[model samples]
Each structure stands twice: as C-alpha cells, then as structure tokens.
Target chain A: MSEKPYVSVENISKWYPYKGDKLINHEKKFIKANDDINLSIQKGEILGVIGESGCGKSTLGKLLTRLETPTAGDCLINGVSTKELIKNDMKAFRRSVQIIFQNPFDTFTPRDTIEQILLRPLKNHNIGNSKEERRKLCIERLEEGGLVPGEDIMKRYPHELSGGQLQRISIIRAMLLDPEFIVADEPVSMLDVSVRAEIINMLLDLAKLHNTAVMFISHDIALTRYISDNIAVMYLGKVVEYGKADEVVNNPGHPYTKALISNCASIDPDDEREEISITGEPPTPLDPGPGCYFAPRCFMACEKCLKEYPDKKNLSDTHWITCMNAE
Target chain B: MKNNRLTIAAQAVKSNRQLMAGCIGVLALLVLMIAAPLISTEDPTIYGPDVLNGLGENGHILGTNHLGQDVYSMIIYGVRTSVKVAVISAMISGILGVLIGGAAGFLGGKVDVIISEIINVFMMLPTFFLILLIVALFGNSLTNVMIVIGITTWPGNAKLMRAQALSLRERVFVKSAEAMGETKRQILFKYIIPNGIFPVIANTTLGMANAILTEAGLSFLGLGDPSIISWGQMIYAGKQYITSAWWICAFSGIAIIIAVLIFYMLGDGLNKVMDPRYNKRRA
Candidate 1:
C-alpha cells in the first residue's frame, strides 16, 4: 500500500465474443474471460493467480502480456498504460513484458533449433553486436536455466527435448529480454511433478535477481502460497479473493477460494482438512446475470448472494474478499 | 525508401534482366510450341537423302540425323511435346498436392492420420522409378507419360503443404489473423497457401525439369510414342552414328539443356519475384 506498484492492472475486462452466438446480433453475447480485474505487483514480487481451467487465469496472463487487448480498461507497467503503449511504443512494451505460455511444445517453432529460438529475441531486440556474441549469450542463458551442455541443446529441435527441458527453455527465453514484468502462465502445469519445483524456483530466483515483477498463474493454491508474496484467486472472470498468500491460505474469506484450497492434496500424513462441497457447475459465461458467478456453487450462498453481486470487503490492510457474506 | 515493398518489387521485376531472360526464353519456347507449323513447313517425320548433314549442309539448318530427318524441324516441333508434358503434369501434381495435403492438414484427426500415412508411403517409393514402372505397364503414350509423372511426383508437394498447413494453422499470428474475422478460404489463400506454396512451387520447377529428363530417358529406351520426333527420339536415332553424326546428339542434347535451363531460370526468377525478401535494396 505504501510503495508504488511496478506493474498494475486497472479494471481490465477481456470479454471474448461468444463464438456460439452470432456476431451480427444487436446484443452480442460475450464470454467475459476477465471482468474488471484489478491487481498490482511491487518490484521483484511474485503475484500467484490460482484458478481452475476456464476461470480466465490464462486470459489474465494474455492480457498482462498484451497478447489479446482488453475490451475495457488498461494495464500499467512502470505507470505507462499498456493499451496506449501498443500504438506508440509497442516494441519497447514487448521488450519490457514477456509471457511464458503453458504448452512448452507449442511455444517453440519446430523448425528452429533451440539456439535460433534463443538468439531471435536478442536479434529482434538488438541485444548483441554480432551473431557470435548473441550465440554466446544464448549459451549462457541456457546453462543458467539448468540445461547443461548448452551448445548441444541449442542445435536440437523442440521435439528432441523433454517437456521439463522445453519449459525451462521457455522461461530462459522469456527472461532473456531481462523484462521488467513477466507472466508465467502455468509454467510447470504440463511438466512432471519432480521438475515443477525446479522450474518454479528457477523463475522465482531469476525474477528476484532481475527485480522483475511476476504474475505466476497456476491451479495449485498450495504451490501458489509457497512461491507468491500475494495470491489472487479467480472464479469465472473475477478475482474472488486477493491478499497475502499466507493470509488467503490460512483464512480464506470467499467460498470459492476455500473450496479451491479444500481440494488441494496435503503432503502431511496427519492432515485432517475438511473438504467443503459446493453444488453445481459454473454457469455459462455468456449470460452470467446480476448475481455473483460463484453464488450457484457457493456453500454459503444465501438469498442476498443469489439476488446481487458483491464488492470487495477488506480483511486487513492488504487482504480483501469479494463476497459480502464473508465473516 | 519507405515505399510499399510490393510496389517496389513490381518495379524491380520489370527492371531485372535475369528475370527478363527467363520470361523471354519461356515466351520464345511458347511461340515455338504454338507456331511450329508456321515456322517450318517441312514434316519432322519425313526422311530424305540429306543424311548426316552437319550444321546447315545441303540446305538443312542444324543438320540431319541418321534418318536424314531435319533436326531443326524436329527440335522446333519437339518444343510442343516437351513443354506440354511439363506444364500439364506440373499443374496436375500441384493441384493434387494442394487439395490432398490441404485437406489432410486443415481437417486434422482421422483425415490427417490417413493422409499422412499415405504421404509417408508415397515418400518411401522412389518417384522416378514408380513413373517408369507405371509407364511401362500402361504403355508410354505422351498422355500416359504426362499423367504418370503428374501422379507420381505429387507426394513431395503434398508432404510439404501438409507440414506447412499443420504448423501454420497453429502459429500465433495466423491464429490471431483467423480470430480477427478472416474467412477460412481467405486465410487459406492469403496466409496459409502463400506461406506453404513456395516450397511446393520450388518443387514444381524441379518436377518439370525431371519430367523432361524422364521423357528423354523413356524415349532413349524406346518407350516413348514412336510417331513424334522428340529430342529423346532424335537422340535415340543418332546414337548409332555417334562418331560421324555427333551433331545429331549434340544439337538435340543442347536443345534439351536449353529447355531445361530456361525452365530452371524461369522458376528461379518467379520465386524471386514472389518472395518478400527479394525487395531488399542493394547499397
């Protein structure tokens, strides 16, 4: 609250036109992927975003990277509006903000060797003087990402490597720009359980080393709590809970965040956490009327919760929940 | 300097002399193919007492082969056969490749699996030998050679288009382009086809040249249509008198080389014209 944020998202709503609905219709239906989303990250801080599939976590990541523009509002990086930056200084904006995609395999072009992929960003960004210097940088970055024998891996194609290796390479590629902010959109979701920690730790350490603000998105709340300074839990298209990771995990205010936390598999043998069961699937994003999106699935849903949507209710100076019914 | 690349490229093509040679050579060959009868009234099939005539002896222009058939008339006439086979077969293969490979790649799932398997199978078979086998079985008529070459050579183009289409559809720009309201056909033609078709196109020129060479090989082996006096047939008819009438094979071989080389140059020039990278200005 005291320090000015390095990266701040200001009520950016990304509502995709519902493909099943006709675009020519006067009242075009929308799948609100991220609606009035607000969050901020300090320099070198990791903001973990935990949400289930189709909960707009990836959409939020895309918005952060300016891959898909928001339908309304803007994201600010170092106080420069990303939306306006697109027209005026898009190349610089791209250099400052990078995204690590979920699918490591698809992120890379198959035809290009790993070295070419590493060198391209440098070439486009004009990082090195000559091809040789750029290539050496590529090798150094690859080794830093824990891919040993960088020279060997650089010459090989994406198909030649493991998913974990490719994911590491993807991180290395993103961080190669020495970005001001990065969105690691489920960087380890597709990876094996053993290597997930390695990748996450690598990202965290690198972000800290570069003083890079990061939006670490994943469905695993426990893991998010482990890596993030702040955690924002998304449901449908809205952030249901935003707080310190420990604050949210220890005392989840929103029914959805509690539900998400309850579903996590604990490592402790004596763990006796109660699983809070809620009813019904998420209603279609196309016509999510006046009520809260989680109201139908919320265990604590009441008549008021069904009839009206709620706004953020402060828990502490830095913690808040969107549910009005929370104690 | 900041002008549209395409407009500049159009101007560049107009001014490029190498491209001009290719176009002029192609144009001259087309004229030869179309105006063979008008240019020379002498029947290329007819043999006379003007045997083994060397380079304009006894009123024959290039010379006569073992049959005393005027090599000049025969070569001018051979343009029709050589160019026709190449053009027609190249079209057939290109069309076949785009359709099959495009469907397989764009459709995906069962269609891709089946079509890709077929492509792999086709790739395994040596294309030239396959064409030879088919021509041998079905009888080596001009039409048959053209059709066989067309069918056998298409798999390479199909494989390329398939790989390109598969990869292109997944590209970030292409996906965003599709999302921004371009119709499938428009995207296919504009984004997909243009990107992928270059490899297919590059393959096509080689295909045409190979077709010419294959036809020559077939004729040398006495498998071509006996009625037409093609360059290959001319070569065949002159092989027996190699020492005395070296001009017969030499001239026919040279004509073949010129034809093949022109096709290559034409293809290379056209490739340059279409490629966006060619718009770069020299210092």
Candidate 2:
C-alpha cells in the first residue's frame, strides 16, 4: 500500500559455528546458515521462500521472527533497525513478526490446555479484560482461522485433535496476536496432503482480511506458487533466483529453478525426462566460497558463474531475478 | 493444552477399581489425621488397667497397647507423624534433587562427573545401615529422622534428575526456546521444571511410603521417639504382650500396611497422570 517496504532484510547472514571438540576447549568449524542475503517485502505483500531442507529457509524465518539474531547486516522493520531496538522494542518486534512452525504438534507445550495455550500470548501482551473476555476472544480467533464451533475445540486437548485440526489451532494461536508479518515456515508440510491446500487457502484468506504480510517458506514449489505473489528460490543457503511467482515458475530464469520446476509433478511429467539434472547433491554451507552457491549443481554453470556471485537483476518493474546470466 | 496425560490419569482413577480403592484409602487416612482427636475415643497416651482386651469388654474397638492406650488412637496419631516425616523429607529431597540434578545435567562436562561421583558414593552406602547410623547418632527425634531421610534420599533423585535433564536439554523445544532469546532462568523454570515435574512427584509419593515403613520398622525395634505414640511404637508396645494380646500389634501392622499402600497407589496414579505417551494411546 505504501511506496516504502514494511520490512527490509539488508545483506543479512547467519553463520553457525560447529565446535569440533567434544571437550571444553570450544574449537570449532562454521556452517553458513544464510549468506549476505538482501530481500524486502512491501506492506500487505506475500513473499514465498522456496528451498530444500538445510538451505537456511527456516533460519531466515527464525531471523525475521527475532528467534535468532542474524550474525551480519540488519533487519529493519518499517525503517527502524532491529539492532537499535531495546528490550521492549524487541518484544514489540516479536509481537509484529510471528512464526508458525512446521511441526504443529511440537509447537505447543504439552502441559497446557488449548485455552491455556491461547491465553499465554494474550497474557504476555496483557491483552483483553477478564478471564471471560479472554476466553471469548480465543474462541473468536479460532473461528476466524476456519475452525467453526471453536468452543468445542477449546475444551479439548491437542492430542484429542487430528493433524488438520491441530494445524488450524496453531494458525488460530498466531492469528490471535494479530501480527503484521507472519513467517509460516512450511506450516502445512506436516499435515496430510489432502488438507494442505485447504490450510494454504485459509492462510491466504486470513492474510488478505488482516492486511498482514506473509513470508511463506516451503520446499514444495507448487504449493509456494499457489499461495505466493513473489517467489524466491534458494539453494544451499543462497537465493539462486527470485521474481514474480508465475514468471519464476513458468518462464524460469535460473538453471536451478528450471530443474526444480521440471522435477515437479504438476509440471508435464515428460519434462522430467528431457530436463537437465544438476550433478551432485547441493554443496554443504560449510566451506562455501565466493562464487555462486548453486554453480556446483548448475548444469549450465560456466567459468564466469563459478568465479563470481550473482546479483539480483531487474526482470520487470515488479520482478527481480538473482543470477549472473539473467542480467 | 490440558495435558492429555492428566485426562488419561483421571480416567485411570475412574476406571481402575484397585487404583480408586487405594486412592480412597489414602484420602480416608488423611482425613483421619486432620480429625485425630475427634476421631479417636481415647487419649492415646493414657495408661490404664493392662489394656490388652482383644474381643472387647472395653471402650477400645481395636484393643489397646501395653500402656493400656488405645491402639486405634495411637495409630491415628501415627498417621500425622508418618505423613509429616515422609512429606517433609520427600520435599527436601525433591527440591535438592532438581537443583543438583538440573544443574549437573544442564551444565555438563566436569559438573556432571562430580555429581555422578557424589551420587555413586551415596548409592553405594547400604540403605538400612546408613539410616540406622544417622538415626542412632541423632537420637530418635522426629526432626532427626526427617533430616536423615531427607539428606540421604536426595542422591537417588538427583541422579535421576541429572539423567532426565541431560535428555531434556537436547529436545527441540528447549533449543527453540533458547534460540527465541529466552533467559536461562526462563528456560529452566518454565521449560525444564514443568517437563521434569513428573519424576519428582512420583518419587515423592514413593518416598512417603518408604518413610512410613521405615518409621514403623524402627518403632517395632524399640528405637522410636519415646515422647510420641506412633504406629511403630504401638506395635512395639503390643509385642511385649504378644501371647495375650495379638490384637494391638496386628491392628498397628494393618495401619502401617494401609498407609504404605495408599502412598504407593498415589504414586502410581501420578505416574499415569504425568506421562504423555500413555495419554496419546488412551486418548
């Protein structure tokens, strides 16, 4: 809605040090979780981040939610730098940027009831009036997340619910806080395939209704395309390609992106046979060099792609692609 | 999230007749302790005509001790003493256990090794012998008994908690909470304590039973606190007139058995209540 972005991630990176010693010395190696990544999301926009496991997609979600501080660069919220924020500001940031984790079951503490679980965040923010008001608010939020007859669900424990129901409850918990930005890190990956679309559609509807920006992270490109307006393709902790969701999925620019689309079952099954498969598994984040992170696995990688990291090239007024040749 | 585990435990108490019976038995004893003077017809310390009337031409229903004090009244008084010793001692052990165990488990390396060594030393000491030595040295006071039991019982619970903490420290939620910028105090109190409360509860109930039984054995051996009329003391007093009045000791022994059974059952109920895996299956 505004010219300026709601949240901007500027050259942020996270490197996890792996201590080699089993003893107390703390000698270690390092694994780069995210590497010099710059991205931005405008107010009320949906940005989907697609990547395989261990590519730091979840790490990105964690950083945005302030669950983990980025080792480098700054994550700015509405032009206010996160680094300068005091304890109260950090709490405000957390309230603004919430995350729904992949495993719906493990996200909640086992000791609490559904009502108690919902009440915790409300209590943390000091929201609502009395116990009765909080209970009424929780039921309303659950209904907003598509769980009608929320009162019945509220009285039952998490284990008593099915996987799909649990996920809806998880979404209700996130929605109750009315966060401005949500990082849904594969929120439906743990659910039965039949219910995944329903959950995704509910999320999209909720986002639209509340004008909340969402960074929908998933390994399933098809699902990402179904929900996202813009898509960022990540490989081995690097965003190899990113643009308008349709363009990136249909007229893909990067070799890694092409390979991924071709491999999808939604794409022509015959495309899988003719498509160039990148050689070897993706390189580990540890010992990653200066060149393109995907060059090792890129079928079209040249000496130039190997020698230098790619920059984000403007594909259209609204689309940006990250690849050397895309320029 | 009303823990499914708690619901399952409630169901177990409702459905299992034996468990319900044991629980009720314990509840009744607790009520009796609180209403001791009201419930008992006689002053438990009063001396009367060699009061060993078994089948009754007397006011005493469960007969009387060598001192002619009602065995029933003495058993009622003992409930307060035995329950007090067990609960206080178990609490001391539980608190100390979680602290030492949690610290050692959470902060591994040398701390774990040192705690393990301390636990091993305590564990190696013969249980009955250690209790006897401490009780003998301290001179048979109720406070002395509680102190000995409390200090000695913790090593086992500490070792248990250490192992539990070590495992819990690695759970995804713990790591996630740490990554969420939660303080160490928050993690330990909010996460570790709630996750680890089951063992402490179970151990405490079991400890109460252990304490009651031990006190009974000590009193039966004439090593009881001379000023207090306990179940074990009643049994000891009855032993002197065993041939003429088997009723006194039998009644006291029955009291001891019921008390121990109740506590053990409470522990079992709690174990069922606190375990989630079982709840999942049942639910």
Candidate 3:
C-alpha cells in the first residue's frame, strides 16, 4: 500500500427517507443505508469490502463511483472533493471512475451489438478519429480482454453471449476508458462458480495493468481477502473492522467478523472448529439508534455496547476495530 | 423461437387483423393523396354543367353539389385536406409530447415535478373544446386549424411518452450510458427517446385518427377554411340538401368514417406488435 491515498472517503452518510410518509405526524424516519463510512484506497491498491446482504456494501460502491452522492460529507480523490465537482467536471469525473454491475445481462444494452456497446464510451469521450477507427479500436479492446477473434463477436448481441463473456466485455469497456478508479460490486457473484475466478482474475489483471484504484464489494470474505490488500467487514451499514487482509483473516477482531470468516466451509474434513453463529437477519435500518448496529446480534454485547457507538480502537499500526468489547 | 425482431414484428402485424385493416386504410389514403392531381385534373372549386346532378350523370362519379361543383373533385380535394390535417397535426403533437415528456421523465426532480404538473394541467383540459375555442378565437384557415389541433391535443401523447420515459430512464442500460460521461441531454435524446419512442408511435397513430375526427368536427360546424374543400364542409353543405341531394353529405360522412377507422386500426396493430409479452408468449 502507498503512503498517500488516491481516494479518501471521509465520514460519508447516505439516508433515504421513507416515501409518502415523511413528517406527516411522527419524526421523519430515514433508512441509513450508509452511516458515516470512512475508508481510503491508494492508486493500484484494491480495497475489498465484505458484508452480509444489504449491509451497505453495494451502496458504498455506488457512493465511491458517484452513482449516488453522499447525503452528507464528501469523498476526496486526489485532493478534490467529489461533492464539490462542478457540472463540466462531472463528465471527466465519470470518465475517471467506472462501476461493474452485478447482473451481466443488465450491463449491456440488449438492443446494442457488442461493437456498438464497446464503441459508445469511446465515441462519447472522443477517443477515436472516425467510425472505422473506433470499430478497429473496439475490436482491439475485445481481443485484449481475451475474447479472441473479436471481429466475430462484434456482430453478436448481448443475449447471444454467456454471463462470463459479457462480464469480460464490461471489464473491457472499463479498461478502454482507462479509468482511475473502479467499483466491482459483486462482479463475479452472479456467474457460475466455475467462471468466477476467471472474471476476478481479469479484473485483478486490469487493475494491476492500469494502476487503477479498485473497491471490490462482495459478501465472500475469502474471495475479497485473496484479491484485496486490505479488507473492511461491514455489519448493517457500519464498518465494524478494517485491516490488512492477512491480519483480518488471521486475527479476526469484531465478533461479527469472526463468525463470518469461520462460517466459510473448507475442503479438508479434519479442519474443524467451534462455529460462532449470529443467527437470523440484522435489524431494520430505519432510524438506527445511537449504538453499535451489530450489538443486537453480537455474542459479546456489553451493556455499554447497547447505548453507545464505539470509536475506532487501534489493534495495530495497520489494523483497527469499531467494537468497544473487541477481544 | 429463433426469429429476429423485424421478422417477428412483420408476422405480428400480418396476424393482427386490426392492424392490417388499419394499415391498408391509411396506405390507400396515402396513395390517393399522392395521386391527387392525376386522379382529377379538373379544379375542385369549379362549377359543373348542371347543379345537383345525381351520381353517374355527366361522368360525375359521386354526382355534383348544389353549387354545381363536381362532387368527385371536391371529395378528392377533401381527402387531400383531411390527410394533410391528420398527418401534420399528429406530427406536431408527437414531437412536442416526446420532447416534453422525455425531458420530464429522465430528469426527475424539480424539473420532473414541474413538467409533470404541466402535463397534468394540460391533461385536465378538454382538448376538443380547447381546439374549438382556439379556432373560434383565431380565424379558421386549414393551416390555422391544423396548428391549433396539433398544439391542443398533445397532452395524451405527452402522458404516454412520460410514462415510457419514466420506465426507460430506470433501465440499467440508461444508467450505464449516464456513467459513461454522456450529458443528460445526450442520454435523453440518444437512449431514452429512441427506446421509449415505440409507445409514443402507437399512441400517435390513434392521435392521427383523432386529428381527422377533430378536423371533420370543426368543418361540420361550418368553421372550415372557405378556400379549400373538406369532408365536414361537404357534410355541412349537404345538410340543407338532405331531403333532395342526400349524396353530398352522405358520401363525405362515409369518407370521414373510413379515414378515422383505418388509422385507429393501424394504431391498434402497432400497440399489439409492440407489446413485449404478446409475441414472446406465442412462441
């Protein structure tokens, strides 16, 4: 990891108010999708975000990619606040950051051929001299993404391609733009297990080649740990723990994090340990209280943990946890 | 199961009796409009040798009006008038509706609310009466009537286009385009409009039929352009002669009904073909 961060998320929060019922009688309740998130990634560094479903991992990715702006606070990319960026600069900002959506089928326009899809970003950004030049460039990019004989693929529509191949094309599009940052929100989760690694490896290769800052969001801790230098575990909408991938994996801090890692079954039958299960779903995000969100499900929930949000207690120079009763 | 879109659409149109009937009617009228001068070189406004000549007398196919005008020539010119009003007025309304509704749908926020409110206000207004008031206020030339009907009757199209735009704007492809650094206007024009245009087209076909009906209604009230001939004007002129020369109003009324029916069928055909679930279930 570099000493300087390329992207710094500073105390960001995203709250969505309940529709048609706001301020009618009682206090206006807002769903805290992301509550005061703070993390950073250096150029060429991958930050893996692991969380249960609807724990704000995808929301974090969206916020990083500026798909949805932070309701409060700002993200700094090379000393420039994302919130402060103006109208003309938004296009450039968008060009710099790209997101790979989870659903491969929905990523590409069904109406557009692969060539049209590939050439669209290029044409929008004025990357080519002419239509013929853009077409050639598209074919080149497709081949580079390992869809060999890209010429044949150009005529095929999106539905004609497999999930894995479509994902590679999406990655190719991101690479074609040469974005500075990327948010792969469960990029491989929707694909067959056999092709997941191939897709992830393609993304990893692209990030390494372009030196792009990547925030890989997924529910699989091991996958994120394998691909990311640093990993942040989220519970509900709060980041419960963040540290080096090895440290988090070897010395899991938050109780929620410990249960999460231990739950991933292994190949060896002899490799056995007592399971620390936090059963059932997390609490609703509507009007979240002023305590740790994980406290309700935490195995080591102290009385203090129920009433107060914990500060980030440093476990090491490179590791931290947001639990007051962390072991 | 493996048919491409164009072939599927063609098959759908072919099988749909409503759409085929409408297409034939509209196409026949279009053909007649194109061949207007060749169909009858004789001036529509010119008086014939005899007044109130019945059908087949002196080579008059539909006979002559009380003014000694060739009923056949007047009907030809009336087709020209009705077709022109329908086409031009529908075009104008469709364009306006697409633009306004598309902008409102894609740019949702204050702009959306404002545009939607405007649409609502326009929707609430009685369009026929609105047209009537405008025509009554402004002198009723063919151009004036066409423009008035075009401008007033756009709210239906706008509402439809707005609904389509609302759905299309949320599509992943649209978001992908937005993330590609395309400007709001560019996305609105290139992506949202094109995808959402099918519904607008189906609705506007129906609107074309309505435009003809509206024009006929205007002319039937004796508010038609004095210089040109129309089916409604022919009907009005034939009203007093109903006891004797019933051919005058009857034939023009029939023309008006035929023109309106065909366009309605065409529009209905388009709707069925465009319905995503319709053919998918068939296959």
Candidate topping lDDT: 3
| Candidate 1 docking classification | incorrect
**Number of the predicted model whose DockQ against the real structure is largest:** 3
- Model 1 stretches with alpha carbons more than 4 Å out: A21-27, B1-283
For candidate 2, give the lDDT of residue B280. 78
What's the candidate order when arranged by decreasing TM-score? 3, 2, 1
As for DockQ, the candidate ahead, 2 or 3, is 3
lDDT of each: 0.82, 0.79, 0.86
Interface RMSD list for the candidates:
7.3, 3.4, 1.4
**lDDT (Cα, tens digit) per residue for candidate 1, span B155-266:** 8889878988998887743443332223456556655676677768867876787788888888888888887778898888789888988878888899899988888876
Docking class of 3: medium
Per-residue accuracy of model 3 over B1-283 as CA lDDT, tens digit each: 2368768667777878898888778778988888877896467788767799898888888888898888777777788899899899999999999999898888889988998898889888988888888888898899989998888877788888888888888777787777787788888887888878898899888888999998889888988887888999999888999989989988888889888888888998899878888778778
Instruction: Estimate, for each residue in A202-253, the C-alpha lDDT of model 3 and write its tens digit.
Output: 8999899889999999988778889999999987788989999999988998
List, residue by residue over B1-283, the lDDT tens digit for candidate 2. 3465578667878865556876898789789989999998788888878456665548787877666777777778888988887788888888888888888887788988998888888888887778888778879888877777788888878877888888887764565444334456766777677787677778777888898888778777777787987888877877878888888878888888888888888877666655667557766
Clashing pairs in 2: A112-B1, A112-B2, A113-B1, A113-B2, A114-B1
